[model samples]
Target: MAGNGGHLTPGLVNTRTHLFQAGLRGIGEGLGLLAWLSAVGEEAARLTPERAYATAAAAAAEALRSGTTTLVEHMWPHPSSEVHDAVLRALKDSDVRAVLCRGVADRADPSRRWGFDPRLMQPLEAALAHTDELIAQARGSRVDVGVAVPNPRCLTPKGMGAVRAYAEGRATLARHGVGVSYNPLSNMRLGSGIAPVPEMLEAGLSVGLGVDRAASNDTQDILEALRIGAYLQRAVHRKADLFGFPEMFAMAAGGANRMLGIEENPDGGVRAGTRADLVLHRFDRDHACLPVRDPGATLLTCGSSRTVAAVLVGGEVLVRDGEHVRLPSREPAAGLARRGSCGG
Candidate 1:
């Protein structure tokens, strides 16, 4: 007997992802960070508008099945407006609560530079205009809008300041200070130095977990990321207890919820008034739980995706008995890939 087992709690929130990149996983193997970015960026640039819709739809389904009720998707630099529409349609149809971070890569003025495919760049002004259009339309939708800037090293000080200003504007509307969700695993994989998460958290900046793009992370498993995050930090600090299972769990679940402005109970999370995003995990029979003492600890160190049993958002069961509730497809958005150099 497996001991009639399962446990329920607040659902996990993936604070950052690039759902459209699900189709491009594992292409950058054996490549250095910059080389990988260029190679993958070029391939991502080749995605057509139709392909974007399909990829986003598939990613949403995967997230739901993995017990993620809320996701913050950092969109790629989409060329077609119809592609953006398709993304929104997918989220709405999937019933996943989300924050859509609009991607911007400017390439008109050589002074405003990033190390990405110039082919995908749009004029900064035009990009902002398009962003505004999307944000305006996102009102009353399940999706909210934020800005995704080129990496700091890819921009001038002035350009970085401009990106901050844009992000701050969204902060005002969201009623929370602008904070960043980051992917340490992807950063290390790409030779990007680890973000100063502890320092930022100490300084009161909201930091959350991100699985990044599929090509970058190769998978969208937030729980696995959670375990890696703790181990990575502990190893970096050369301290056995630097980031324990509890802290990382808080980061992926409650900590992320806080950054998104989701309310929490003093007792912990998911009260009557708060959004009802939650996950259930079963570990009784799994070898990972053989000698389980602390469930959270066992989950962090021993569990895998198979541990997840159920997921819910806003009190609606999205996954039950370990299966996703299939949603009917809606009208597809226009297109996914574009081939122009516009800048904002």
Candidate 2:
């Protein structure tokens, strides 16, 4: 394929997402975190295996379309193995590299103010066993399994010990080095305060961009996350020079690889020995991106999914000419919207 006057760069890695919430988009508008979760929980309670497949596929398709080659799906606890299996199938079918984090929460609260929603809570033993099962199922695929906990408050002392034991040598923050998933859009939408990204960088912490979930973010567009993440820091610090385009671009691409235990490219670019997870963005194709002065600055400021000419994951062309190679031409999210009445 011809470059066609496009810029080729490393594909984005979305550090955190709840893909099952794709069907629950636009549920809790204009509400804070606690109130929003209450509203979303009602929809979450109705999740089925079929719904999980459709929503996760739709979410993964959107992420791939927007140049996110990798995603970390942070699934909340569910008793049904079918639902988890459906998510894994969707991700594998989408051909996006993923870490499926099966969630566990022991402290259940009906009100969900201080603890996890009881409807989604399961026994820690069962959750750990299920995670192992998922890991086995994903052995030879692009998808991998990990454990997810909502927060420290959601776990009991014993539950914490079990979770720690489970994660002792696998995907632990201390072992792999700490990383932050900076989700600007979700934080803004939920009225969560801005993350101290500048401070995190100053402290030499690895930080990566994330869209959070379709429910809170309403879209899995990592380009928007990249732009907003940098703008927020600049506006708060009252310094236009806070985060440069190259630095923010790195964060959007491969900055959190260490956190996820994925090996980073030697120089973090299209080098001889690097992985072929790449994106080709055409500035000439988009009016907003035309007359590009600096490719990095223009991409950070004006690039959208529409400007992505192609996306390659592991040397496989998943998206060519801005369309997913395997997915149908019809919008994947359409199925979720049609089934919206199910949640209601």
Candidate 3:
């Protein structure tokens, strides 16, 4: 009977992506990272929570189809808690484990040089307060809240201090078990320099990965983030291979699981009893199999999300025939976009 059943595999983990920006897929259109953020941020204000939710759900479906089972979502709060709660309910409805990264903003950050007009950065207290509200709002929802500090470069010392304080506050509630995801490259691409990754890692924090907004990235691939992370450590120490490949894979795998803080322990590799999370490829047993003394090398260098065959979560086929089930409509966001770049 096990053989009679069609083969199923685990999904790829998309460490970071703004679900709302999936609409910006080709719309980025060559803008430099900073300019792109400016354009996209302005553009995103048009999205209603409903639209963002639908878009995010659709992205989840896409990930499942493209070999992503568990998605660690760094989503912005809705117009209200009810709206966010509804979104989480929808995530359960759609069948993907959602780890919502509740991010705090900092208006007083000096790195505002990255096309961040004074009008954009909301006051620190306002963001902190709202973030707290959102956390409470998300309570009891299928979605889990993981606190994310804006990269230090994205915030001034004062702003980062506030963010750190917020993280501390959340720790008291999530029982010091809350997870964290940061986007240093996004900060640096916007001329904000590296976030204090070393510091955060040292703070007894559950550090994880995320690419932030697509507008801030040249490429949205998780592999690129892996590569960037290694180079970043090297630049920090002027020593290449400082973190190394083993560390990078751990970041892509276990780091994401750590970010989710899933109840089931996560080794994140394709080992048995690890939630059946895996990505099956279309290799002819030669493409990725040949010269296979080093399978990890083949995947790290030549493996791509493109060869993904199916995405299974908890042994359920969320994706089959390369399509995610229960996708929602996105015409609203597109229609709103056509009307104006969010009247914000």
What are the models' TM-scores?
Answer: 0.82, 0.96, 0.64
Candidate 2, residues 9-83: lDDT per residue as tens digits? Answer: 888899999998888878889988888988877777778888888889988988998899999999988877888
Worst 10 residues of 1 by lDDT: 335-344
Order of quality (TM-score):
2, 1, 3
Candidate number of the best TM-score: 2
Native-vs-model 1 lDDT?
A: 0.68
Q: Where does the lowest 10-residue lDDT sum fall in candidate 3?
A: 1-10
Whole-model Cα lDDT of every candidate shown, in order: 0.68, 0.85, 0.54
Residue 181's lDDT within candidate 2 is 95
Per-residue lDDT of 56 in model 2: 91
Per-residue lDDT of model 1, residues 1-344, tens digit only: 12256666676778888887776667678788666766666666566666766667767767776667778887766566777777777777777888877777654333223444666666666666788887887888667777775565544566567766776676533455656676877877777777777777788776677777767787777777777787877778788887676667667775655556555322335567677788777875366566768777887887666777667788777766555675422321212223231110
Give candidate 2's error at residue 70 in angstroms: 0.6
Best by lDDT: 2
Of 1 and 2, the candidate ahead on lDDT is 2
Alpha-carbon deviation at 71 in model 3, angstroms: 3.3
- Global Cα lDDT for candidate 2: 0.85
